[model samples]
Target: MLEIQFFQKIEFLQHRLVAVKKSVMVKTRKVFKNLSCLTVISYKFKGENIMKRCAIVTADLQNAAANKHAARIKAVEAFLPEHTEFLNKMRAKGIPVVHLQQIYDPNDPRKYKHTDYDKKFIEGSHEAAILDEVCQESDIIVQKHRDSGFYDNNLHDVLQAMNVEVVILTGMQSQICVQTTAADATFRGYEVLVPSDGVSATKPEDTERALDWMQKYVGTVKTQKEIYDDVLAGELIGGKHT
Candidate 1:
């Protein structure tokens, strides 16, 4: 009878050890699950809060000098250095830079209707390529056939994914692609900032008119210098000036 009691006690102790091991495994899993959730939350918060919620959107910085838009190329090149410097600074701050490139689809029947100069911009052509001065391997490239970068494209989605709140417009043809994009961005509830010196047109008057229109309806119009100042002052994204 004593031997029986000893064996029974041993069995009870073994059962208790198994139960304790199961409980420890369950608690460990719960702790790890909670830690995983916390890590994701922390990463999201850092992306949306700690970093600037602003992006630089450049339109059509291509080799347009060989096309009918040669004047547009010249106009953009004049301020290209300033835009490049601003892009570098923004990149250093972890701000996103999106480049809009006009690439004509050669497979489309519409290609037959375009002028030879326009044909030079067909996909894989030299003229269709983004300018080396402003193009970066790390920058997001959005190939477009329409004037507006957001037209039937994923540009808006890209911005939304980055949690961008404000968009600074730059590049050639201020009266066309830039203006249209500004309007679209406004419609999508993004604050627009057009740098007066950063955009250009075929003529000086067109640039001025586009800037005025954008200021009245789309968003604010400021020079690159002024905008950079705002960035330095912590006013680019969610600060007082934004």
Candidate 2:
């Protein structure tokens, strides 16, 4: 009886010690991990102040106007002047902007019935480059081969790394790239928004339908000014800005 009690006491004491050791190790590991993230961010991004948990994701707004699709050019161009001004305002608020550009690849997410001849979006073409006016030094550029910015690209990974929760979708071809990217963002667990005034399409009806479709499956569609006010007020869809 005495021997049995001694062995049981030894086992109990061992279990207690093991649990205490694990608790200490867990706390130490959490501290180390936080320190690691701080070190990496401090070293990599020197002076740029990163506002946590939100970003502006813009789809193809490439230059080399002559090489663009005529219909897309005709429609999207009408909103460029306004879009440009909105983008500048958004970036001024310490919001990180990610520019998604499509480069030619045979396996692009969407199959185009149109020819690729004289296309500005082909790889190695300046026509595929971002327009100079909206370009900023702090912008993160993600080159993609697909219609959705998330398709075969580092966009999601980059956003996750930045700890982003809300993604504001902006850019050209309301029914195509903008719509597709927003859908992908929804599927990938982002709180998505499309400023109605920030996008354009080949026709007014197309843009309207795309906006309706996006609101149903992807996100809310609001005017840029409305979105900007909400952003400033910190009342985004998913949660308040931190």
lDDT of each: 0.71, 0.68
Q: What TM-score do all the candidates reach, one by one? A: 0.71, 0.69
* Model 1 lDDT per residue over 1-242, tens place: 00000001112354432111111112243543443221110112212323357889999888863245567556666777888887887776566789898876656567454777667777776788888878788788888878888987898888888778789998878999999999899888887899998887778899898897787566779988787777776756521121
lDDT by residue (1-242, candidate 2, tens digit) is: 00000001112454432111111112343553443221110111333333435788888888753225787677766788887787788777667888888777655445562355424567767888888777789888898876789998799888887778779888867888989999888778876789998887767898898887776555678899987787677554222224
Instruction: Please list the residue runs of candidate 1 whose C-alpha ends up more than 4 Å from where it truly belongs after superposition.
Output: 1-52, 65-70, 107-113, 237-242
- What is the lDDT for 10 in model 2? 16
TM-score of 1: 0.71
Query: Best candidate per lDDT, number?
Result: 1
CA shift of 144, model 2, Å:
1.1
Q: Considering only N, C-alpha and C atoms within 3 Å, which residue pairs clash in candidate 2?
A: none
